[model samples]
Target: MSAPLASLPPRRLSWQFLRLVTPYWKSANKWQVRGYTLALLLFTLAQVALAIWMNYWSRELFDALEDKSLNDLLMQVGTFVLIFILTMAVTALHMQVKRWLQLDWRRWLTAKVLDQWMTRGHHYQLQLVGGEHDNPDGRIAEDIRIVTESSIGLVHSLVYSLLIFGSFVDILLTVTGSATFPGTAFMVPGYMVILAFAYAGAGTVFGLLLGRPLITATNKLQTAEADFRFGLGRSRSNSESIALMHGEDIERQNAKTFFARLSQRWNRQTLGYLGIVSFSSGYGALLPVFPILLMAPQYIAGGMTLGVLMQAAQAFQKLTSALSWPIDNLGELAHCRASIQRVLSLYNDMQVLDEQASEPQEHRISVAQSTQHELVLRDLCIANPDGLILLEGFNQVVRRGEHVLIAGDPTVTISLFKVVAGLWPWGHGEVWLPEGPAISFLPQRPFLPHASLQSVLSYPQPAEHFTQAAMHHALECAGIAWLAPRLTELDSWDRVLPLRAQQRLGFARLFLQQPAWVFIEEATDAFDPKGEEGMMDMLYRELPNATLLTISFHTGLERHYQRKLLLNRPAQDKYLTCSTSECSLTTAPVTPVVTAAD
Candidate 1:
């Protein structure tokens, strides 16, 4: 039974939407959300009460006009002024309350999504392992806004419509009462209500059928829009590179391609809207005359007054409007559905990542804290996600205070660094680390976060953690003292600073932190040999007891390390072979080289 229910299309979609939105209602802001919800409910009830009063007023005004009673018409006109003022107040308050709730919900949702996306480097993993979530930034920024506003608007409209239907259905039944055909025994009770239902129900069925393609079209439009925006952002970020390469034409063509796809989806949505409008317009235009046509004989026979005929028409309109919600807002419904699906897809992906991290796996690298003051890798096997072995059966230990250089195929060396840093764990291995040593890893191109120069220098740490004097000293030792005075200034320091300056800053951070263990991945490659030597000399001078593991192609740094490790891969094999060489202070120069078969 549950399986069958799950197989139902509407139920599946509703379940997905509820799952995506339930977190907000149950979140820490539940009390505030409930307060806003209560206000909206009261507003909706007020509107319904106003509608009922106005319906009766309409009948009274019309009957006064029909009888040519000037005094009654003047009194009804005064009543109209009061009703209009109250309606305006109610409408304004409703809109303000709705907007307030939308903003609060959007704020909470944005924070929640950002936290989930950024936690545990899940955002990086998503980019590395591409899947259905193409552009998370758009989902968090644009889709969340659409979902919150549209869902609230739609729910309010739906609830109000239902209230109107309930209040006016009895009025319609009372006015139309029962109809009997002449010379026939058949009688249809509350025929006005039944006619309104049948008319609106048919229109709804046709509306849904005509609007079915809109959901897919809207989804495609959103994706294409995100892709196009991303393309524009990428072009802006890489403007300097493009300008240097004179690739303006290529970039323009890429923009045109993305725009073309977006336009195609827009055209499809337009066509879908055409069908919906054509049907809904005709259906709605005929509603006012429907009740009149059904009761014309009673008015002609003097059984119904002009006011009663008008009242019956008004009640029928209300009942049909309530039942025609799907027909009126089908396009919005499609858009809401698409937005909900996109957000839920992102949420589900994050959940999947969390689940994968928690579950035990046979191939996961075993990591533990060790009593020994060294970093150890025992029988380590590193492989890509596709199971292509990069390094296998490798066992090694780097004791405390050892300066070692690993020279290998750039890919393998980088992978090894990531493995040791515990970023890449899709392999069989056991890694043991000294229990209480702070470690830092610097990659080939250091990351300078978008922050104050001080924050960027002391990153993964707050700006206040280091004194201005310490930062100045580290900068001077790293041979980039020119940056010391600008530490307080904030900007996109990553883009503002030159490559050599950024690399110098990485070392500056290392000097300030003075971690017990440091892993360097070609961090000094951007610097000239003399500059590289100066930075290396500063490292040895400042943190003499720190264990240094450097991965670099330049053999010029060979004299700085007391030991060397090399990785080799033969053409016939899939795994790497590791070899180590120990050197003494007086040993002759030995260049460590890594060769991999094509």
Candidate 2:
């Protein structure tokens, strides 16, 4: 399930990259995006044209100085002003166009990945089918920015280099002309052109050799950084529990461990950078002087004028610089590749999940909807993520308006609740649900988002969806009517409210939703016996005809439900070993539901 996407073979990596990027080009705004891209390209072309004009302008100014003519110098000065104005305008416009395209592409890519990550239970499923996608938040937020911005910058530079190489190669050839060795009759044509290629070729080969280590180091460093961020984020999220357990010292150690790992990777990447930088320094220092020295012999011999010699040196430098693009950008290329790999890995794993879900498996759970107003579980079996059977050979049918109490091992009951809601799929069975209204599940701990109290009550629905009176009534029924006045105040309700108050808010949502079917999992555990009884009474008072299923260990809950079912574990302490294909039913007894009449 995991592979080094950064080390993928060039052809496969290109295909993967194209697969990711092609969607935006063909999206609904393709024409507008294309127009912007076209404008950027035109600006690039304009930049190259300006560079070529400046090359000739330099020749004229240098020649005028050599000729000692005031009129020619003045004429060249006017041309210089024209070139300066045009260069400034083109450079500024090119920057704007490039930024527009980069941001637009980044926005599209971010939205696309977010949709895949959040929709249709993919977020939950991704955790179950784990792979290299550890910190999805880091990948979406930081890595996407690097991929979009660096990619555009790299591509523009590459195109500019190619254009310069093409235009300047011919100029170097013409200016250098044919050369003969001092003592020989044999002459070499366009010798400077040949020398420029050899210089750039040698630099490119050595640059890549030295840069190989950098690519590996960069990928590892990025992963370490992401892990460190994830550790911090997790600690922040569970700060309340950590504080209550007095686990701050353990958390400090964990943070130190994350940072130690990051520091080790940083040192390795620094070593990688050293080699490339040393070689680049020597190569850059020689570029300007190397061309002039070769042209020096011809200039001293009076075979070429100062104007032609200077122009020839300039042409040689431009041609070689164009060919040196790979050498100049080696580090940035490594960084960009690392980001692309992280993004592609997340995308590929999600795609694999989709593929697995589409193909049918013999022991896989199948969830279906029926027109009948009842829930049916046929030959149900529940297993944990490790393929160990927790509960098996279960069958149940709950009709509308039945109040059922489920008492069992906590793990088994929670898994059953998720199975019915279609959130846990690691079991074999058929779950036929009523088609009209969705089932509502309230877990042990309620999640209160940071928002207005009114919005908190109407979460997953608009605040305006419920009338003010209904909101107030729900609050009263849940025993938190004191919050009614603060419905408009925005705050972090989860942080400020106590566990009991948060539980009340959860029940208030159930009142607002008014679902036909409801499942509760120890949501009343925070309350005392009297408070729990009052909450139960309030539920029946508000929605007497609604079908209710409660999973709890509280003593008096049995009195509220007409039927009681007890889940019994086997005497054996070991888990039932089984594979998906040949899963055998566990003999763990499940006591049949007994009616209150019995």
Candidate 3:
């Protein structure tokens, strides 16, 4: 029976996002975040000091030049040299500190998100509604990289802007005070504030107006590109099938059409980017002149010295940096936000299903009673993802050494194995397998990780764990001895091997591992009847004492088993089950336990 988790889940983005991000701080390198933060704090404080001293140095050096005292000139020169040295050292240290911090943060974030992707079985369950709903592979591998890099860069730029603003604001106010219109104190605080806000708002609004569309466009384009790539992959992997069907021209035409869409979207995005750059670059070059124009009157009236004039110019440049923080980060910030929304949406959708398990499955599976049977699913009930009732009160028992065959419905058997393997969580009723029994499941599509042949042969166990003799023996038993010579030659053996060969390898591992119980799905679905019989013979010979449970609708293998069970989708509420004609294949219905917390 499948695990039941039927409930709507909470998906407030802010809270869920925080829950997602919290795991990074709990990683093994947590102390590194602390150490880097301390260094950044010290470096930031030092940077502020240096910036302030430079402002004072500007005025003092000009004063010394006006006085023309050799002693004062020498003193100013030496002080300037020392200030330069200190500034260089501080900047270098800050750079190194930030580099490590950025990398540390990225590593922590990627690892945490990746582990979550693999842990919840969301990666597999996500496959059902399969037109690129969520690619955990892309999310973990690429999206995390973008988010981490963009986030760190944004933080650094914001911090630097804050320090620059703090260092120059006082100097700016003093320089502006020296200027006057006749007699009344010149007041331009309001003008400066208004300008800052206007500049930031314009860039933000413009960037969003032009850039937001690109994010969504790029995401769509990426999916299309992946589809096109996957089509090519299919061509490569199923060359024999494609060739037999004479689909070369058909596939070529389809691929050309897919690439055409990809090209169309990319071209539009390029134009959008060009439009943004045209507007932004115009603003950048014109910005430096505005500060000088605002302060021109002070220098002309002799209200400020050359040093004070330079300081005022620097201040205006500094002000632009402060006002333009968002503008500078607009691209990265947009991409980061887009990625956040995407990842957040996926996490929410995946989690939303099992939030509270409020809706119980039609067939309630539970432990009616322990019968000292090898396996017992009491009053088991399950439904397809589309609400099609698959199995109801699907009672079954496997004796200690009996080989049981579950036949009749192809869809039913496949769904049942998924539920029993503890991979599918959409069904109800408790499936009781003795806790101590070792259960090994082989699905129709088995996982083939990228590694050496030896590593592939000894999957779930590292390559080093298996002896050379054992490696050859296992491959030979699986009739995959063609790989024996390449045991040390590492590659993607799973993809390289034929589906039949891979299943043979899976069976070989099953036999070699000698699990207490073996649950076989349509692992041999792609193979001929003879091949299926051959593999079953090998399985029995290898694990004569092991309890064998098989799911097959072929009926050809029916002769191999003593106990046979069948299932059908009778209705939305009732799933059909029949063991033999006279029995009517029915069992007592189970009452599922549900609590408020459940």
Of the candidates shown, which would achieve the greatest TM-score relative to the real structure? 2
Name the top lDDT candidate: 2
Alpha carbon lDDT at 347, candidate 3: 53
Report every candidate's CA lDDT. 0.82, 0.85, 0.67
Q: For model 2, how does the per-residue alpha-carbon lDDT over 1-598 read when each residue is reduced to its tens digit?
A: 6576766886788788888998887898999989988988899899889888888887888889999989999999999899899999989988998998899999999998888898656677778776778788899999999999999999999999999999998888887898898899999999999999999999999988987889889989999999999999899888888999999999999999999999999999999888888998899999889988998999999887788888888888889999999989988988888898999988888787666455454356678898899999887767775566666667888899999898867777888888887777776778899768888889888778889999999988899999999999999999999999999999988778888999999999999889899999899999999999999999998888899988998868788998876765434433334453455545554433322321
Clashes of each: 0, 0, 6
TM-score of each: 0.89, 0.93, 0.82
lDDT of 1 by residue, 54-95 (tens): 999988998999999999999999999999999999999999
- Tens-place lDDT per residue, model 3, 352-388, is 4334133333322333234464787766766655444
Full-model lDDT, candidate 3: 0.67
Q: Give the TM-score of candidate 3.
A: 0.82
**Where does candidate 1 stray beyond 4 Å?**
1-8, 182-185, 366-373, 568-598
